[model samples]
Target: MAENQGFIGSIVETVKTVFWALVIAGIFRTLFFQPFWIPSGSMKDTLLIGDFLFVNKMAYGYSYASCPAIRIERIGIDLGPDDFCGWFEDRDGRLFGSEPERGDIVVFRHPVTGRDFIKRLIGLPGDRIQMKDGLLHINDTPVEIEDAGIFAEVMAPQGPLGLRPQCANGAVGEGATCEKEKAIETLPNGVSHSILNIGRRSADNTGVFTVPADQFFFVGDNRDNSTDSRFPQAAGGVGFVDRKDLVGRADRVMFSSAGRSMLAFWTWRSDRYFKALE
Candidate 1:
Protein backbone atom coordinates (compact mmCIF):
# COMPACT_ATOMS: atom_id res chain seq x y z
CA MET A 1 0.00 0.00 0.00
CA ALA A 2 2.85 2.41 0.74
CA GLU A 3 4.47 1.74 -2.63
CA ASN A 4 1.18 2.46 -4.42
CA GLN A 5 0.73 5.65 -2.45
CA GLY A 6 4.25 6.81 -3.37
CA PHE A 7 3.55 6.15 -7.04
CA ILE A 8 0.40 8.23 -6.85
CA GLY A 9 2.32 10.98 -5.10
CA SER A 10 4.91 10.99 -7.89
CA ILE A 11 2.20 11.42 -10.48
CA VAL A 12 0.73 14.30 -8.54
CA GLU A 13 4.10 16.03 -8.33
CA THR A 14 4.64 15.63 -12.07
CA VAL A 15 1.28 17.16 -12.82
CA LYS A 16 1.95 20.06 -10.50
CA THR A 17 5.32 20.73 -12.10
CA VAL A 18 3.84 20.75 -15.57
CA PHE A 19 1.04 23.03 -14.50
CA TRP A 20 3.39 25.57 -13.01
CA ALA A 21 5.73 25.42 -16.00
CA LEU A 22 2.86 26.17 -18.35
CA VAL A 23 1.65 29.03 -16.21
CA ILE A 24 5.08 30.61 -16.21
CA ALA A 25 5.50 30.15 -19.93
CA GLY A 26 2.13 31.73 -20.60
CA ILE A 27 2.94 34.74 -18.49
CA PHE A 28 6.38 35.12 -20.05
CA ARG A 29 4.98 34.99 -23.56
CA THR A 30 2.23 37.42 -22.76
CA LEU A 31 4.15 40.08 -20.84
CA PHE A 32 7.63 39.96 -22.28
CA PHE A 33 8.50 38.45 -25.66
CA GLN A 34 6.57 36.60 -28.31
CA PRO A 35 8.16 34.05 -30.59
CA PHE A 36 7.80 34.67 -34.34
CA TRP A 37 8.74 32.41 -37.18
CA ILE A 38 9.75 33.68 -40.57
CA PRO A 39 7.61 31.95 -43.17
CA SER A 40 8.54 34.03 -46.20
CA GLY A 41 11.53 35.52 -48.00
CA SER A 42 10.06 39.01 -48.26
CA MET A 43 12.93 40.24 -46.08
CA LYS A 44 15.52 37.97 -47.62
CA ASP A 45 19.22 38.35 -46.72
CA THR A 46 18.10 40.37 -43.70
CA LEU A 47 15.47 37.86 -42.54
CA LEU A 48 14.97 34.60 -44.41
CA ILE A 49 12.33 31.93 -44.57
CA GLY A 50 12.59 29.58 -41.56
CA ASP A 51 14.27 32.14 -39.36
CA PHE A 52 13.01 32.17 -35.78
CA LEU A 53 13.11 35.11 -33.44
CA PHE A 54 11.34 36.60 -30.46
CA VAL A 55 9.51 39.89 -30.78
CA ASN A 56 10.30 42.46 -28.06
CA LYS A 57 6.82 43.31 -26.90
CA MET A 58 7.95 45.99 -24.52
CA ALA A 59 9.68 48.00 -27.22
CA TYR A 60 6.54 49.83 -28.20
CA GLY A 61 4.49 49.01 -25.09
CA TYR A 62 1.17 47.13 -25.08
CA SER A 63 -1.89 47.35 -27.24
CA TYR A 64 -4.80 45.13 -28.09
CA ALA A 65 -2.72 43.83 -30.96
CA SER A 66 0.01 42.75 -28.55
CA CYS A 67 -2.11 39.82 -27.46
CA PRO A 68 -1.01 36.54 -28.94
CA ALA A 69 -2.94 34.86 -31.73
CA ILE A 70 -2.93 31.18 -30.94
CA ARG A 71 -3.68 29.06 -33.99
CA ILE A 72 -3.05 25.35 -34.00
CA GLU A 73 -4.61 23.90 -37.11
CA ARG A 74 -3.90 20.29 -36.20
CA ILE A 75 -5.88 20.55 -32.98
CA GLY A 76 -8.56 22.77 -34.52
CA ILE A 77 -7.80 25.62 -32.12
CA ASP A 78 -7.85 29.11 -33.55
CA LEU A 79 -7.80 32.27 -31.48
CA GLY A 80 -7.00 35.81 -32.53
CA PRO A 81 -5.76 38.85 -30.63
CA ASP A 82 -9.30 40.18 -30.66
CA ASP A 83 -10.49 37.17 -28.78
CA PHE A 84 -7.93 37.73 -26.04
CA CYS A 85 -7.91 41.51 -25.81
CA GLY A 86 -10.92 42.67 -27.73
CA TRP A 87 -12.07 44.59 -24.69
CA PHE A 88 -9.00 46.78 -25.16
CA GLU A 89 -9.76 47.43 -28.81
CA ASP A 90 -10.65 50.83 -30.31
CA ARG A 91 -8.51 52.50 -27.65
CA ASP A 92 -6.78 55.74 -28.57
CA GLY A 93 -3.20 54.50 -28.12
CA ARG A 94 -0.96 51.91 -26.57
CA LEU A 95 -0.24 51.71 -22.86
CA PHE A 96 3.15 53.26 -22.22
CA GLY A 97 3.30 53.81 -25.97
CA SER A 98 6.51 54.71 -27.73
CA GLU A 99 6.97 55.81 -31.30
CA PRO A 100 8.79 53.49 -33.69
CA GLU A 101 11.83 54.81 -35.44
CA ARG A 102 12.13 55.10 -39.20
CA GLY A 103 14.04 52.28 -40.95
CA ASP A 104 13.39 49.86 -38.10
CA ILE A 105 12.26 46.34 -38.91
CA VAL A 106 8.77 46.00 -37.45
CA VAL A 107 6.17 43.29 -37.17
CA PHE A 108 2.62 44.60 -37.26
CA ARG A 109 -0.90 43.27 -37.62
CA HIS A 110 -2.62 43.99 -40.89
CA PRO A 111 -5.20 46.73 -40.42
CA VAL A 112 -7.85 44.89 -42.41
CA THR A 113 -6.94 41.20 -42.18
CA GLY A 114 -5.35 41.01 -38.72
CA ARG A 115 -2.59 38.89 -40.25
CA ASP A 116 0.97 39.64 -39.10
CA PHE A 117 3.55 41.14 -41.46
CA ILE A 118 7.20 42.11 -41.00
CA LYS A 119 8.76 44.95 -42.96
CA ARG A 120 11.05 47.93 -42.74
CA LEU A 121 9.37 51.08 -41.52
CA ILE A 122 9.83 53.56 -44.34
CA GLY A 123 7.53 56.55 -43.96
CA LEU A 124 6.28 58.04 -40.72
CA PRO A 125 3.04 59.87 -40.24
CA GLY A 126 2.66 62.67 -42.78
CA ASP A 127 5.68 61.54 -44.74
CA ARG A 128 5.67 61.40 -48.56
CA ILE A 129 6.72 58.02 -49.91
CA GLN A 130 7.16 56.99 -53.52
CA MET A 131 9.04 54.58 -55.70
CA LYS A 132 10.62 55.67 -58.98
CA ASP A 133 12.61 53.66 -61.51
CA GLY A 134 13.05 50.86 -59.01
CA LEU A 135 14.41 53.26 -56.39
CA LEU A 136 12.95 54.33 -53.07
CA HIS A 137 12.03 57.99 -52.85
CA ILE A 138 11.14 59.71 -49.59
CA ASN A 139 9.79 63.21 -49.41
CA ASP A 140 10.54 63.73 -53.12
CA THR A 141 14.21 62.74 -52.70
CA PRO A 142 15.62 59.39 -53.82
CA VAL A 143 17.35 57.33 -51.15
CA GLU A 144 20.99 56.42 -51.76
CA ILE A 145 21.60 52.93 -53.08
CA GLU A 146 24.94 51.37 -54.02
CA ASP A 147 25.49 48.12 -55.85
CA ALA A 148 26.37 45.26 -53.51
CA GLY A 149 26.77 42.50 -56.11
CA ILE A 150 24.52 39.48 -56.49
CA PHE A 151 22.78 37.50 -53.76
CA ALA A 152 22.71 33.88 -54.88
CA GLU A 153 20.87 30.86 -53.50
CA VAL A 154 20.00 27.40 -54.74
CA MET A 155 16.88 27.28 -56.90
CA ALA A 156 15.30 24.63 -54.71
CA PRO A 157 12.24 24.46 -52.50
CA GLN A 158 12.63 26.64 -49.39
CA GLY A 159 10.94 26.31 -45.98
CA PRO A 160 7.77 24.30 -45.33
CA LEU A 161 5.75 26.15 -47.94
CA GLY A 162 7.96 24.65 -50.69
CA LEU A 163 7.88 28.05 -52.36
CA ARG A 164 10.67 28.49 -54.88
CA PRO A 165 12.44 31.79 -55.10
CA GLN A 166 12.00 34.26 -57.96
CA CYS A 167 15.30 34.78 -59.74
CA ALA A 168 16.59 37.79 -61.61
CA ASN A 169 18.29 35.41 -64.04
CA GLY A 170 14.95 33.99 -65.15
CA ALA A 171 13.62 30.51 -64.47
CA VAL A 172 16.11 27.83 -63.58
CA GLY A 173 15.88 24.15 -62.70
CA GLU A 174 16.18 22.90 -59.14
CA GLY A 175 19.72 22.82 -57.68
CA ALA A 176 20.76 25.64 -59.99
CA THR A 177 22.12 28.96 -58.75
CA CYS A 178 19.41 31.61 -58.37
CA GLU A 179 20.53 35.19 -58.25
CA LYS A 180 19.12 38.63 -57.44
CA GLU A 181 20.69 42.04 -57.78
CA LYS A 182 21.76 43.23 -54.34
CA ALA A 183 22.29 46.79 -53.27
CA ILE A 184 22.98 48.63 -50.03
CA GLU A 185 20.18 51.11 -49.50
CA THR A 186 20.61 53.95 -47.05
CA LEU A 187 17.45 55.31 -45.53
CA PRO A 188 17.08 58.98 -44.75
CA ASN A 189 17.72 58.19 -41.09
CA GLY A 190 21.14 56.77 -42.12
CA VAL A 191 20.11 53.20 -41.46
CA SER A 192 21.65 51.08 -44.21
CA HIS A 193 20.51 47.62 -45.17
CA SER A 194 20.78 45.30 -48.13
CA ILE A 195 17.94 45.33 -50.64
CA LEU A 196 17.37 42.72 -53.31
CA ASN A 197 15.91 43.33 -56.75
CA ILE A 198 14.37 40.85 -59.18
CA GLY A 199 13.93 43.21 -62.08
CA ARG A 200 11.34 45.99 -62.30
CA ARG A 201 7.59 45.54 -61.88
CA SER A 202 4.54 47.70 -61.26
CA ALA A 203 5.70 48.38 -57.69
CA ASP A 204 8.83 50.01 -59.02
CA ASN A 205 6.95 53.18 -59.94
CA THR A 206 4.09 54.75 -58.06
CA GLY A 207 2.48 58.10 -57.51
CA VAL A 208 3.29 59.98 -54.33
CA PHE A 209 1.74 58.37 -51.26
CA THR A 210 0.95 60.93 -48.60
CA VAL A 211 0.76 59.05 -45.33
CA PRO A 212 -2.08 60.07 -43.08
CA ALA A 213 -1.76 60.94 -39.41
CA ASP A 214 -1.15 58.03 -37.03
CA GLN A 215 -0.30 55.80 -40.00
CA PHE A 216 3.07 54.55 -41.25
CA PHE A 217 4.43 53.18 -44.50
CA PHE A 218 6.40 49.97 -44.76
CA VAL A 219 8.17 48.11 -47.54
CA GLY A 220 9.93 44.83 -47.99
CA ASP A 221 13.65 44.49 -48.47
CA ASN A 222 13.01 42.07 -51.29
CA ARG A 223 11.68 45.00 -53.29
CA ASP A 224 9.81 43.38 -56.15
CA ASN A 225 8.56 40.38 -54.21
CA SER A 226 6.87 41.97 -51.21
CA THR A 227 3.28 43.23 -51.27
CA ASP A 228 3.70 46.07 -48.79
CA SER A 229 2.30 49.54 -48.23
CA ARG A 230 2.93 50.43 -51.83
CA PHE A 231 -0.27 48.63 -52.77
CA PRO A 232 -3.79 49.17 -51.47
CA GLN A 233 -5.41 46.75 -49.02
CA ALA A 234 -8.36 46.26 -51.35
CA ALA A 235 -5.86 45.23 -54.00
CA GLY A 236 -4.27 42.62 -51.67
CA GLY A 237 -1.52 44.79 -50.19
CA VAL A 238 -1.00 45.87 -46.58
CA GLY A 239 -1.72 49.56 -47.38
CA PHE A 240 -0.89 51.96 -44.53
CA VAL A 241 -0.59 50.30 -41.16
CA ASP A 242 -1.95 52.04 -38.07
CA ARG A 243 0.17 52.66 -34.99
CA LYS A 244 -2.14 50.68 -32.76
CA ASP A 245 -1.50 47.53 -34.76
CA LEU A 246 2.22 47.53 -34.07
CA VAL A 247 3.27 44.31 -32.39
CA GLY A 248 6.97 44.39 -31.61
CA ARG A 249 10.51 44.68 -32.91
CA ALA A 250 12.55 41.68 -33.95
CA ASP A 251 16.04 42.35 -32.58
CA ARG A 252 17.85 39.11 -33.48
CA VAL A 253 17.51 35.77 -35.15
CA MET A 254 17.47 33.00 -32.54
CA PHE A 255 17.68 30.22 -35.07
CA SER A 256 17.38 29.53 -38.80
CA SER A 257 16.88 26.42 -40.85
CA ALA A 258 17.13 26.07 -44.60
CA GLY A 259 15.05 22.93 -44.68
CA ARG A 260 11.32 22.33 -44.49
CA SER A 261 11.45 21.32 -40.84
CA MET A 262 13.45 23.08 -38.17
CA LEU A 263 13.97 19.75 -36.42
CA ALA A 264 16.04 18.58 -39.37
CA PHE A 265 19.33 19.29 -37.64
CA TRP A 266 21.43 18.95 -40.75
CA THR A 267 19.55 21.78 -42.45
CA TRP A 268 20.27 24.31 -39.72
CA ARG A 269 22.19 27.46 -40.62
CA SER A 270 24.70 27.70 -37.81
CA ASP A 271 25.91 31.19 -38.74
CA ARG A 272 22.51 32.70 -38.14
CA TYR A 273 22.22 31.55 -34.56
CA PHE A 274 21.82 34.56 -32.29
CA LYS A 275 22.68 36.85 -35.18
CA ALA A 276 21.85 40.50 -34.54
CA LEU A 277 19.58 42.26 -36.95
CA GLU A 278 20.50 45.64 -38.35
Candidate 2:
Protein backbone atom coordinates (compact mmCIF):
# COMPACT_ATOMS: atom_id res chain seq x y z
CA MET A 1 0.00 0.00 0.00
CA ALA A 2 2.89 2.37 0.81
CA GLU A 3 4.56 1.69 -2.56
CA ASN A 4 1.31 2.40 -4.43
CA GLN A 5 0.84 5.60 -2.46
CA GLY A 6 4.40 6.67 -3.31
CA PHE A 7 3.74 6.14 -7.03
CA ILE A 8 0.60 8.21 -6.87
CA GLY A 9 2.44 11.00 -5.01
CA SER A 10 5.12 11.05 -7.75
CA ILE A 11 2.48 11.49 -10.45
CA VAL A 12 0.88 14.36 -8.52
CA GLU A 13 4.24 16.11 -8.15
CA THR A 14 4.93 15.77 -11.85
CA VAL A 15 1.58 17.29 -12.76
CA LYS A 16 2.13 20.15 -10.33
CA THR A 17 5.58 20.86 -11.76
CA VAL A 18 4.25 20.96 -15.33
CA PHE A 19 1.39 23.23 -14.34
CA TRP A 20 3.72 25.73 -12.68
CA ALA A 21 6.16 25.66 -15.57
CA LEU A 22 3.38 26.45 -18.04
CA VAL A 23 2.16 29.29 -15.86
CA ILE A 24 5.62 30.82 -15.74
CA ALA A 25 6.09 30.45 -19.48
CA GLY A 26 2.75 32.08 -20.19
CA ILE A 27 3.60 35.03 -17.99
CA PHE A 28 7.01 35.46 -19.57
CA ARG A 29 5.57 35.38 -23.06
CA THR A 30 2.76 37.76 -22.27
CA LEU A 31 4.59 40.36 -20.20
CA PHE A 32 8.24 40.36 -21.17
CA PHE A 33 8.93 38.89 -24.61
CA GLN A 34 7.30 36.78 -27.31
CA PRO A 35 8.93 34.56 -29.85
CA PHE A 36 8.36 35.43 -33.53
CA TRP A 37 9.35 33.36 -36.50
CA ILE A 38 9.97 34.97 -39.85
CA PRO A 39 7.89 33.01 -42.37
CA SER A 40 8.25 35.40 -45.30
CA GLY A 41 11.06 37.07 -47.19
CA SER A 42 9.58 40.52 -47.06
CA MET A 43 12.37 41.61 -44.71
CA LYS A 44 14.92 39.62 -46.77
CA ASP A 45 18.60 39.94 -45.90
CA THR A 46 17.82 42.01 -42.82
CA LEU A 47 15.45 39.33 -41.52
CA LEU A 48 15.52 36.06 -43.43
CA ILE A 49 12.65 33.67 -44.00
CA GLY A 50 13.64 31.28 -41.22
CA ASP A 51 15.01 33.73 -38.67
CA PHE A 52 13.75 33.38 -35.11
CA LEU A 53 13.72 36.30 -32.72
CA PHE A 54 11.98 37.48 -29.60
CA VAL A 55 9.79 40.58 -29.69
CA ASN A 56 10.30 42.91 -26.72
CA LYS A 57 6.72 43.38 -25.60
CA MET A 58 7.69 45.66 -22.73
CA ALA A 59 9.44 48.10 -25.02
CA TYR A 60 6.27 49.82 -26.14
CA GLY A 61 4.20 48.76 -23.11
CA TYR A 62 1.16 46.47 -23.08
CA SER A 63 -2.00 46.86 -25.07
CA TYR A 64 -4.79 44.70 -26.41
CA ALA A 65 -2.46 43.73 -29.23
CA SER A 66 0.28 42.78 -26.77
CA CYS A 67 -1.66 39.68 -25.92
CA PRO A 68 -0.44 36.67 -27.86
CA ALA A 69 -2.68 35.14 -30.50
CA ILE A 70 -2.74 31.40 -30.30
CA ARG A 71 -3.72 29.42 -33.43
CA ILE A 72 -3.47 25.68 -33.67
CA GLU A 73 -5.08 24.27 -36.78
CA ARG A 74 -4.68 20.60 -36.01
CA ILE A 75 -6.39 20.94 -32.64
CA GLY A 76 -8.81 23.54 -34.08
CA ILE A 77 -7.91 26.29 -31.62
CA ASP A 78 -7.89 29.89 -32.84
CA LEU A 79 -7.74 32.77 -30.40
CA GLY A 80 -6.76 36.32 -31.18
CA PRO A 81 -5.65 39.11 -28.88
CA ASP A 82 -9.06 40.71 -29.09
CA ASP A 83 -10.63 37.52 -27.78
CA PHE A 84 -8.47 37.53 -24.67
CA CYS A 85 -8.44 41.29 -24.03
CA GLY A 86 -11.59 42.52 -25.69
CA TRP A 87 -12.18 45.11 -22.99
CA PHE A 88 -8.78 46.62 -23.67
CA GLU A 89 -9.65 46.78 -27.35
CA ASP A 90 -12.03 49.66 -26.69
CA ARG A 91 -9.31 51.59 -24.86
CA ASP A 92 -7.67 54.51 -26.61
CA GLY A 93 -3.99 53.89 -25.99
CA ARG A 94 -1.64 51.35 -24.56
CA LEU A 95 -0.87 50.87 -20.88
CA PHE A 96 2.25 52.91 -20.12
CA GLY A 97 2.82 53.28 -23.85
CA SER A 98 5.56 55.21 -25.61
CA GLU A 99 5.90 56.35 -29.19
CA PRO A 100 7.90 54.23 -31.61
CA GLU A 101 10.93 55.78 -33.25
CA ARG A 102 11.32 56.27 -36.99
CA GLY A 103 13.50 53.71 -38.82
CA ASP A 104 12.96 51.19 -36.05
CA ILE A 105 12.11 47.64 -37.07
CA VAL A 106 8.66 46.95 -35.67
CA VAL A 107 6.19 44.11 -35.54
CA PHE A 108 2.59 45.26 -35.72
CA ARG A 109 -0.81 43.78 -36.39
CA HIS A 110 -2.51 44.38 -39.71
CA PRO A 111 -5.32 46.86 -39.25
CA VAL A 112 -7.74 44.84 -41.34
CA THR A 113 -6.51 41.27 -41.00
CA GLY A 114 -5.40 41.25 -37.37
CA ARG A 115 -2.35 39.34 -38.53
CA ASP A 116 1.15 40.11 -37.23
CA PHE A 117 3.57 41.81 -39.62
CA ILE A 118 7.17 42.88 -39.18
CA LYS A 119 8.47 45.91 -41.06
CA ARG A 120 10.57 49.00 -40.67
CA LEU A 121 8.71 52.00 -39.27
CA ILE A 122 9.10 54.56 -42.03
CA GLY A 123 6.70 57.33 -41.19
CA LEU A 124 5.31 58.68 -37.94
CA PRO A 125 1.83 60.00 -37.47
CA GLY A 126 1.13 63.05 -39.68
CA ASP A 127 4.22 62.37 -41.75
CA ARG A 128 4.15 62.72 -45.52
CA ILE A 129 5.44 59.55 -47.18
CA GLN A 130 5.86 58.67 -50.82
CA MET A 131 7.81 56.40 -53.08
CA LYS A 132 9.10 58.32 -56.08
CA ASP A 133 11.16 56.65 -58.80
CA GLY A 134 12.30 53.85 -56.49
CA LEU A 135 13.44 56.32 -53.83
CA LEU A 136 11.85 56.85 -50.45
CA HIS A 137 10.72 60.39 -49.86
CA ILE A 138 9.64 61.82 -46.52
CA ASN A 139 8.17 65.28 -46.49
CA ASP A 140 9.26 65.82 -50.13
CA THR A 141 12.93 65.12 -49.42
CA PRO A 142 14.32 61.84 -50.72
CA VAL A 143 16.29 59.50 -48.48
CA GLU A 144 19.95 58.77 -49.32
CA ILE A 145 20.96 55.54 -50.97
CA GLU A 146 24.42 54.20 -51.83
CA ASP A 147 25.09 51.17 -53.96
CA ALA A 148 26.17 48.19 -51.85
CA GLY A 149 26.98 45.56 -54.45
CA ILE A 150 24.71 42.61 -55.00
CA PHE A 151 22.88 40.16 -52.74
CA ALA A 152 22.82 36.64 -54.10
CA GLU A 153 21.16 33.44 -52.92
CA VAL A 154 20.49 30.02 -54.30
CA MET A 155 17.52 29.85 -56.66
CA ALA A 156 15.64 27.27 -54.63
CA PRO A 157 12.53 27.14 -52.51
CA GLN A 158 12.95 28.82 -49.13
CA GLY A 159 11.23 28.24 -45.80
CA PRO A 160 8.18 26.04 -45.22
CA LEU A 161 6.08 27.93 -47.73
CA GLY A 162 8.46 26.91 -50.49
CA LEU A 163 8.42 30.41 -51.87
CA ARG A 164 10.88 31.13 -54.62
CA PRO A 165 12.78 34.39 -54.49
CA GLN A 166 12.44 36.95 -57.27
CA CYS A 167 15.78 37.67 -58.84
CA ALA A 168 17.09 40.81 -60.48
CA ASN A 169 19.09 38.67 -62.86
CA GLY A 170 15.83 37.35 -64.29
CA ALA A 171 14.73 33.72 -64.30
CA VAL A 172 17.34 31.02 -64.00
CA GLY A 173 17.40 27.25 -63.66
CA GLU A 174 16.88 25.82 -60.21
CA GLY A 175 19.98 25.86 -57.97
CA ALA A 176 21.47 28.71 -60.03
CA THR A 177 22.46 32.00 -58.41
CA CYS A 178 19.64 34.49 -57.81
CA GLU A 179 20.78 38.07 -57.48
CA LYS A 180 19.34 41.40 -56.43
CA GLU A 181 20.86 44.84 -56.40
CA LYS A 182 21.80 45.82 -52.87
CA ALA A 183 22.15 49.33 -51.53
CA ILE A 184 22.66 51.03 -48.18
CA GLU A 185 19.69 53.31 -47.55
CA THR A 186 19.89 56.04 -44.96
CA LEU A 187 16.63 57.24 -43.50
CA PRO A 188 16.11 60.87 -42.53
CA ASN A 189 16.68 59.89 -38.90
CA GLY A 190 20.20 58.71 -39.90
CA VAL A 191 19.32 55.05 -39.54
CA SER A 192 21.12 53.15 -42.28
CA HIS A 193 20.25 49.64 -43.46
CA SER A 194 20.66 47.47 -46.52
CA ILE A 195 17.85 47.22 -49.03
CA LEU A 196 17.53 44.81 -51.91
CA ASN A 197 16.03 45.89 -55.20
CA ILE A 198 14.75 43.48 -57.81
CA GLY A 199 14.24 45.94 -60.68
CA ARG A 200 11.44 48.49 -61.03
CA ARG A 201 7.71 47.84 -60.61
CA SER A 202 4.55 49.77 -59.84
CA ALA A 203 5.51 50.18 -56.17
CA ASP A 204 8.70 51.95 -57.25
CA ASN A 205 6.71 55.10 -58.05
CA THR A 206 3.71 56.10 -55.98
CA GLY A 207 1.90 59.31 -55.16
CA VAL A 208 2.28 61.05 -51.80
CA PHE A 209 0.72 59.29 -48.80
CA THR A 210 -0.31 61.33 -45.79
CA VAL A 211 -0.28 59.14 -42.72
CA PRO A 212 -3.33 59.58 -40.50
CA ALA A 213 -3.16 60.49 -36.85
CA ASP A 214 -2.46 57.57 -34.50
CA GLN A 215 -1.35 55.59 -37.53
CA PHE A 216 2.14 54.44 -38.50
CA PHE A 217 3.77 53.67 -41.86
CA PHE A 218 5.87 50.60 -42.50
CA VAL A 219 7.90 49.19 -45.40
CA GLY A 220 9.86 46.07 -46.13
CA ASP A 221 13.64 46.08 -46.63
CA ASN A 222 13.32 44.25 -49.91
CA ARG A 223 12.13 47.27 -51.82
CA ASP A 224 10.63 45.85 -54.97
CA ASN A 225 9.31 42.69 -53.38
CA SER A 226 7.48 44.40 -50.51
CA THR A 227 3.81 45.31 -50.53
CA ASP A 228 3.84 47.83 -47.73
CA SER A 229 2.34 51.27 -47.00
CA ARG A 230 2.90 52.09 -50.65
CA PHE A 231 -0.20 50.00 -51.33
CA PRO A 232 -3.64 50.27 -49.81
CA GLN A 233 -5.22 47.71 -47.49
CA ALA A 234 -8.08 47.24 -49.95
CA ALA A 235 -5.47 46.19 -52.50
CA GLY A 236 -4.21 43.45 -50.17
CA GLY A 237 -1.41 45.58 -48.78
CA VAL A 238 -0.59 46.70 -45.26
CA GLY A 239 -1.90 50.25 -45.40
CA PHE A 240 -1.42 52.60 -42.45
CA VAL A 241 -1.13 50.50 -39.31
CA ASP A 242 -2.67 51.81 -36.12
CA ARG A 243 -0.60 52.58 -33.03
CA LYS A 244 -2.66 50.21 -30.92
CA ASP A 245 -1.68 47.36 -33.22
CA LEU A 246 2.00 47.68 -32.44
CA VAL A 247 3.31 44.50 -30.89
CA GLY A 248 7.04 44.97 -30.13
CA ARG A 249 10.51 45.53 -31.52
CA ALA A 250 12.80 42.82 -32.80
CA ASP A 251 16.35 43.63 -31.71
CA ARG A 252 18.27 40.55 -32.74
CA VAL A 253 17.95 37.24 -34.51
CA MET A 254 18.34 34.48 -31.95
CA PHE A 255 18.62 31.77 -34.58
CA SER A 256 18.21 31.20 -38.32
CA SER A 257 17.80 28.17 -40.50
CA ALA A 258 17.77 27.90 -44.28
CA GLY A 259 15.95 24.61 -44.38
CA ARG A 260 12.19 24.08 -44.45
CA SER A 261 12.20 22.99 -40.82
CA MET A 262 14.10 24.72 -38.03
CA LEU A 263 14.83 21.31 -36.52
CA ALA A 264 17.12 20.61 -39.47
CA PHE A 265 20.25 21.21 -37.40
CA TRP A 266 22.56 20.93 -40.38
CA THR A 267 20.78 23.85 -42.12
CA TRP A 268 21.44 26.26 -39.28
CA ARG A 269 23.21 29.50 -40.15
CA SER A 270 25.70 29.89 -37.33
CA ASP A 271 26.72 33.37 -38.48
CA ARG A 272 23.28 34.78 -37.72
CA TYR A 273 23.10 33.41 -34.20
CA PHE A 274 22.31 36.29 -31.83
CA LYS A 275 23.10 38.77 -34.63
CA ALA A 276 22.06 42.27 -33.64
CA LEU A 277 19.64 44.08 -35.93
CA GLU A 278 20.50 47.49 -37.32
Residue-pair clashes per candidate: 0, 0
What are the lDDT scores of the predictions, listed in order? 0.92, 0.91
**Collision pairs in model 1:** none
Best by TM-score: 2
Stretches of candidate 1 exceeding 4 Å from the true structure? 1-12
The candidate that achieves the highest lDDT relative to the unseen native structure: 1
Over 4 Å off, model 2: 1-4
| Model 2 TM-score, all chains together | 0.96
For 1-278, candidate 2 gives per-residue lDDT tens digits of 99999999999999999999988998898898989999988998899999999999988888899987899978999888998887898788888747799988998888888888999999999899998888999999999999999999999999988989999999988999999999999998889999999998999888889999988999999988887888899999999988888999999999999999989999999999999998
Model 1's TM-score against the true structure: 0.95
How do the residues 1-278 of candidate 1 rate in per-residue lDDT, one tens digit apiece? 99999999999999999999988987787678999999999999899999999999898889888888888889998887988999987997888847899988899999888888999999999999999999999999999999999999999999999989999999999899999999999999899999999997999999999999988999999998898999999999999998889999889999999999988999999999999998
